[model samples]
Target: MTIDFTQQALQVLQIEATAISQLARFVNDDFNKACQLIMDSPGRVIVSGMGKSGHIANKIAATFASTGTPAFFVHPGEASHGDLGMITKDDVVIAISNSGETGEVLTIIPVLKRIGAHLIGMSGNPASTLARLSDVHVCVQVEQEACPLGLAPTASTTATLAMGDAMAVALLNARGFSADDFALSHPGGSLGRRLLLRLEDVMHTGNTIPMVPTTATIKTALLEMSAKGLGMTTVVDKHGVLQGIFTDGDLRRILDQRYDIHDTLITAVMVRNCITAQPQMLAAEALKLMEQRKINGLVIVDQHQHPVGAMNMHDLLKAGVL
Candidate 1:
């Protein structure tokens, strides 16, 4: 007996897709009420489940926690052993079980109620004991399981996960959660770095900035660019105001024109009114400007139009903004 793996995989996908689509109907008043309960709670949301449900519960708890709702997962088995103490009157408990008859989860309900905690149940059976006992029940029922044997948690788990995501996102929008707020919770990740890093934080400042007076020769500008290793130098006037910019590209063009690099003034060949950026601008935004303008470097200027700092594509790459 040979199994056509491709056909079986397609069947599983079709079954799960249908299950997710069917879940849209169940996102009615009960789902809104569940979101309200979680939003109003001053304490954390405690999520618990058994077996495969337990794994999904953990992920759901993490999503809630990261999206502005304080939450954590507690295993049903552990809750029975003593972790039930983690629940308090100020918290909301979300219990998960496909059949809604998981022995360990059901056993801890009476104690949770006694502790004045609110119970929210997610189950496939609305008539199950867990759902009946909950303050609010979320139905995660599916027409069938993706498992060919009609066993195992497949489509059911996918629907349950989607339902949890919907709840978390609803609450997140209700609270007006922003990307910056999300970044705070994920400070160690790439998103945090992209949102938090500023141009000033990574730009070469002080003596490291490649700059030359307008009176300086192109040769002097090249020396500054070489010493600073930024491939560019800002040309300032006598009053220290930004006059123009000279780069290696400009040098190549100047050489093609046969300009006297040894004696020609930088002001004669530098690109005047060059693109500049503020120190406070985000590095990611600066990278966008660079790509849009087809430039590799930017001169950081203050309000007085004086060059204060300098940075290039290499600097942004080193700062993880590339």
Candidate 2:
């Protein structure tokens, strides 16, 4: 008889999903108190657990840190060997144990209480020692393990992880954490670029901005565009106020119109009343605008309608706004 691997995988998924869905009932008054505990604390959060719960605890700590709460994970095994010094009276400790009887974690509880740090226990068994000893208890109890052996911590870990996310999100909303605030802590990733980067940050500035006077010939505009390497040129008046814009696309369109490049004034052939952007606009917002208008570039203008910068689709791509 052949065992169906796909059916077993489906069973595992269903069990885990049900386990997570049932976690809603576990978010009780104790959960509300835990959130208030973290919020009211002036110190960082120190999360601790052993084995599989340790991994889940580590991820929960990361989520807390990224979502505006100061948090870090400490290995319970290491805590017994002088690492417990990292915890202080002002900090909040999140202790995780599915059975709530893990020796290393239990061993540190006495020291933590001596240090006066508040304890929040996450355990499957509400009657477990950890729950009984903790200042507050969060139940991550699941009906059954997704593992066929009922020993691999599958559904329990899933439930615990979901509970951690729910906690982080609740705290996040309470703190009014914004994406820009998150980007400050995660500055090297695409998410940071999307949240923190503005139009002025990516747009070509000063002499690099491609521009030609409105009276300049189409040839002058092409020269400016080529020199700036932006594939487009802003047409400004004598006062440097934006008049219009010209681009490679404009060149291509005018090619069919039989215009003399050197003799035709840029204003005569340039797109009049062209789309523009403010320097303070978000690069992501600008990308959306460009996509909506089916445009390749935008001229950055000041409040007085003076051209201050210029950017193209390639600039946005280079800045990771795409």
**Model 2 per-residue lDDT tens digits across residues 214-262:** 7899888888888989889998889999989888888888888888887
Displacement of the residue 20 alpha carbon in candidate 2, Å? 0.5
Off by over 4 Å in 1: 1-3
- Cα lDDT computed for each candidate against the true fold: 0.94, 0.93
Clashing pairs in 1: none
lDDT of 1 by residue, 33-146 (tens): 999999999999999999999999999999999999999999989888889888899999999999999999999999999999999999999999999999999999999999
lDDT of 1: 0.94
> Could you tell me how far off, in angstroms, the CA of residue 137 lies in candidate 1 after the best superposition?
1.4
Most lDDT-accurate candidate: 1
lDDT of 1 at 73: 98
